[model samples]
Target: MSELSMGDALKLFLQKSRLKGSMQAMQITDIWAELMGKTIARYTDKIQILNRTLFIATSVAPLKNELLFQKEKIIQRVNEALGENLITEIVIR
Candidate 1:
């Protein structure tokens, strides 16, 4: 038997389980509302992750503008929440 580093072993487990994407997606969705606050979540029409980017649909134009201005800050908050640099960008529509 051989010893494996914690990071390497976890990576192998995630790869074999095929849960990495789904788990991360779920985590982001669950945290979005909490981090953004109730008012923002109410304005958010929908959200999804694809290809390392977060896609968010806003119900109102003002909300879109607000999010656009805070996009980088929001991304940083999300990465800090997840404890991983998972998202590269946010697409608001």
Candidate 2:
């Protein structure tokens, strides 16, 4: 078998572990501002991932409506940023 680099090994482990979703959620949170924008990220109150679904919580009504319309784009941007098709759905609240 070929040797795996440290980064590759860790990635393999994360992929097989139950912490994958949590880890991905953290990663998404970390990059949210950069991924979306300061305005959107600032308005976003919470982010969670479960069963490949992304949940975004924002108290701003206008922002929530805007997010609802951008669900598809958000999924694409998030998955692309993560370098994987990890998010399959999004819930805006």
Candidate 2 lDDT, 1-93, residue by residue in tens: 999999999999999999888899999999999999999999999999999999999999999998899999999999999899989999988
Candidate 1's TM-score:
0.81
Which sections of candidate 2 miss by over 4 Å? none
Local distance difference test, each candidate: 0.87, 0.94
- Total backbone collisions for each predicted model: 0, 0
**Lowest-lDDT window of 10 residues in candidate 2?**
15-24
Model 1 vs truth, CA RMSD: 2.8
Error of 2 at 82 (Å): 0.6
Highest-TM-score candidate: 2
What are the TM-scores, per candidate, against the unseen true structure? 0.81, 0.95
lDDT of 1 by residue, 22-93 (tens): 877888889888989999988897878777798899879988999999999988988898788888899999
Ten residues in a row with the worst lDDT in model 1?
Answer: 15-24
